[model samples]
Target: MSPQKWDENHPARILLLKEMNEGRIPLDSNEMGPAEVYYKYHSTVEFQVEGMEYNSTFTSRLRRLREQIRRDQGKPEKATKTKTARKKKDVSLTWNENHPARILLYKEIAEGRIPLDEKEMGPAEVWCTYHDTLEFQMDGVEFNDNFATRLSSLRAIVKRDQGRAANDRKALEKAMKNHPVQELNHRGEPQWNGSLAQALLQQDMAEGKHETMRPSELWEARPEYKEAFSRKDDFRWKIRQEIRTKKYLYTLEYRAEEKLRKNLKKEGIVLPDQDEDLDGVMDLEEMEDT
Candidate 1:
């Protein structure tokens, strides 16, 4: 029940305020709207798997998402749940529900405006289909630029995230190569210090030092991207080589000019426009080789 539904002078409201002051509870009475929370209870849906009882919103959402994907792929949707299929905690739920980009996408999905085969469609295609609608309409409210960009670049963003995950995994494997799991273990047995390893892995992922690149890092990756990165590197190398060659040729010419001036001085040959000082080698060097 909403706190607003109760009388302002109600004992529960007074108790809620007291609870807020105590700060023992996760919720703040002043922070929460009346309808936000009355009784601190969680709602869960029970789904049986392997004759074991489990209840979580994560399972329900994954079940729904898989079915949706299967339908999009022109395959029979898995309406029935598997007995052994269990849902781990949702890694995306916390981010997705609160994310501005996905929030806009979900709004479209909730409105039934998004096609069922959205999985098959790219973000550009989705944007083109609802470009005018999303760009202008927000229930007559002004369009938000942040939301607009997110809605437009939705698919690309998801693809990038997927690539990041793959890259992060690869990075973890490579890191573990040197610091073997057995080495990290105290007993030096086959047992691995998973907790420590996990922490390190999370730190590296957060730093994004090994995050995958698409067209830019292509040379180190796929054949298509290889050409682009290699081509750029080759161009840079050629430029550096040309600069080095010019520097070498210039150095050689300077030495040759020095030798020529020394020889001329030894021969006592005072070519035209003689300078009072003998140190004017630059002036002599400037003379044309006629």
Candidate 2:
């Protein structure tokens, strides 16, 4: 990869901020001006703004950036209630960039060697495939059981993040429908509430905010509905469903492990002695915790 060049579009300010956040630039930046701090750590990094001389303009530019950061930090809670939606952070940022396994995993992903689609293969399967790759061997990265766990975690984070935007959009739409920005009509005339707004507000306060539901009212209205849901079968069915899911997951993990073991054996890597199999080590209490 070519060394990154900083200009007007991609300022050294961004890199400076990132380094500060990650504790890489641990200098007392507030005391020392941005220019001094930047030059201290990133002395070799030549940053220049368009049509602006670096010696004269860079300090002023950094001052503006700092002021902007301060303004953002000092923003009031109510200031965020504006119609404009905030930018969401990328889901990939949740993973540690410096992680040995993740660095290789992301490289493979970028190279189109490893697909990010978890629907096609499980996390363990992905790790097993990743293990046998030339990139993994060339990097001299050793096997770790937690690689599979991290893959699963990252997949879950991505899935959850993907759903969040849709959920936010739905919520915004619902909110717009319920309480519009302009309550007045096209003619700028006062609209009739008909006590609906107040009633809705009261209902929201009770049900949504406080979660105060009237079970007795529902039971009286539909006795069968309550009886059906309250049955022991419903509770037992959930437990059975969870058991099935765990069993399926364990099976996938076992197969992935077996495949990895065989690959390692082929590569002349010593296999670690295992005291027990997955089934033998399965704890009822641990299953319940899940």
Best by TM-score: 2
Please, what are the lDDT tens digits per residue for candidate 2 over residues 116-173? 6766776666756765442243223444555566666666555575579789999999
What are the runs in model 1 whose C-alpha is more than 4 Å off?
1-101, 104-119, 122-149, 183-290
Cα distance off (Å), candidate 2, residue 165? 13
Clashing pairs in 2: none
Tell me the lDDT of model 1 at 102.
Answer: 49
Off by over 4 Å in 2: 1-228, 280-290
Q: After superposition, how far is residue 140 of candidate 2 from its true place, in Å?
A: 13
Could you give candidate 1's per-residue lDDT for residues 178-257 as a string of tens digits?
66655323433222123442333334434553244322342343342232223546424433343344445555556554
Clashes of each: 2, 0
Q: Output the worst ten-in-a-row residue range by lDDT, candidate 1.
A: 44-53
Best by lDDT: 2
